[model samples]
Target: MIRLPDSSGRLRAYTPVGKGGHGAGAQGPAPRSRTVFAAAHVVADPLADTTPEGPAAVDWDATLAFRRHLWAHGLGVAEAMDTAQRGMGLDWEGAAELIRRSAAEARAVGGRIACGAGTDHLPATGQPAAGHTLAAITAAYGEQLHTVEETGAQAILMASRALAATARGPEDYEQVYGALLAQAERPVILHWLGPMFDPALAGYWGSQDLDTATDTFLRVVAAHPGRVDGVKVSLLDAGREVALRRRLPEGVRCYTGDDFHYPELIEGDAQGHSDALLGVFDPLAPLAAQAVRQLDAGGAGGFRATLDPTVPLARHLFQEPTRYYKTGVVLLAWLAGHQEHFTMVGGLQSARSLPHLARAYELADGIGLFPDPELAQARMKQLLAVHGVH
Candidate 1:
């Protein structure tokens, strides 16, 4: 039994439903119709001095083991992505190493893997001439793209903070992407991360009006049909994402990064559905695998029945200040025993409040995510006590 805090500031006693309580139905083969990848997180070296402005020091063993865990459950790994804290705390040097190591690990186990390639290496404050900025951003991307291809992994052209800061209009985006896409060793996934995730990207696609932006985005894809594989939309607006999905040129997939409404998007409508490259999938792996298995077995009803119950938990973890949702992710990972401590790169564990985390814990427990409820309860109590909770 565990006592947890609710919204009204009272502790509620809860019992363990335990893992396997959901039954997960029998795990079938991976989903055939959809390509699912879980944008993974890194385990911080708890002993490192991970200050707000300092460099990140990660636990290589734990980090790689988590990827193996995802692959073991039949999900591809989306490495060094936002879920891995790319712009937040992880530097380009760290991300490059992670890509090489994770890509190598995936090869050893026959796991599908894609790594984020972006222009995060550029200093955020440096203001250069427009041409200089575009050239530098392109060079930065080229460097990371080279690293990813050299490591034998697919590349995801992540939305660039530098480009977002520098670009004057859609033509600049097209010029930069067109050049990079032409040089790709294979078709790569493009990313359109919304301003909600990174405010620096407020006017993506050269317009605040998403429809206009979508048009410009499509124009880029139109110019390079064979060079693009798909686009990962993390806008959190389902209607817009669906709209974009319907418009993508044939053969280009829309990988849903909408954490709040993934089941419906992936299950999709009659015309087509989005594939997935989601951050929520990191914490929801076992359940997601089971749900995808159900879909693979042609039991859409079973798939919905399995996944719908977990939405409240997902919604809570992904609540406002959505970027900080990474805190809840690492917290759940700790309570569920994925890592020994809740510490994060750059001390991001402190990003969320105690109450926010308490709610996340309660919600996860409600869904039977913790393999051992007793252990989860104990960890929760330990965390609360640290914050002076009686």
Candidate 2:
């Protein structure tokens, strides 16, 4: 429960509902001995648009602080990846600079870091000029890949909206990936993002049909066994991801990006489990890191106990009109005191509804996502006041 003075300075109590009062064994996340990766997003400055190059604003201090928080929890940071609003509002130039900045920060702190390499600069909506071809796309990937490598960061080969727009079939996916993999300095994680996150990737990996796309995607991984380190599956389809994980090359990893169903996906079945690479983790770092440590103790039941409760809040934050999910994410950051204000790049904080955000606050408070739930509730009420919803 929370007690705070209202606009009129009258104190009132607000009770926060939790998951029936259970912890440490009610089906939370299990600890993983394997290295866990989180494709973290950059927290934006609330007061101004910092992206002089484009619409996105990058809150340098808060963003780096969040990364430090993840590192403190022992999770590897995958910077400049999709979770950082890449292609949404964060432009390619901004992404490259972010990778460079974060790489330096990671090095300064002895943290693990990886950066995304994609063809977002190739234009997601406009027609390619007359002579454009996959070669151009390949070159684009090469440029970004080299930049990441030069920064001394591992590479996450993200899916291309441009490729999805122009591919003829699975063959296209194979050809593009094969070329990129052949030249990589080290084994890289290939990313397969579903359209749910960004509709522009509707038929990513060549075919619109998921099964065919998976087949084509895995074939690339299979063909380049040594060069591809692992695959980041963001299809939000746990079953398919599991099936695909079973088929990966011996040394490769299956990094899950399914925020909708991560606890179960990472928990794995008899076959195997996925390593983490989620945007949700950016906000749930401490809790996720703690749960994974429990799993490492042969206590999955306990791990899930810690994570399951947060699912409702995660689901709510990532609610449909899905891409706009960033809004709720930033809101929680502000309320949790990770950032000083509630603003977002491209003004994305205004994306969700009052009731929607209201429920997010309620659910978050319920799960104890905040260290000081009272402060969170007070901030939430202030947010409600801005929209005249209180």
Residue pairs in collision within model 1? none
Off by over 4 Å in 1: 8-10, 19-29, 126-132
Q: Quote the positional error of residue 322 for candidate 1 in Å.
A: 0.5
What lDDT would each prediction earn against the true structure? 0.87, 0.79
Q: Which candidate is the best by lDDT?
A: 1
Report model 1's TM-score to 2 decimal places: 0.95
Give the per-residue lDDT of model 1 (tens digit) for 255-367: 99999899999999998999999999988988898888888889999989988998898889888888898999999888888889989998889998887898888878878
Off by over 4 Å in 2: 1-14, 17-32, 49-53, 124-131
lDDT per residue (tens digit) for residues 136-248 in model 2: 88899899999999988999999887777677778877888899999899989899888889987888887767888888888898898789888898877778888889988
Question: Which candidate tops TM-score?
Answer: 1
Q: What is candidate 2's TM-score against the reference?
A: 0.90
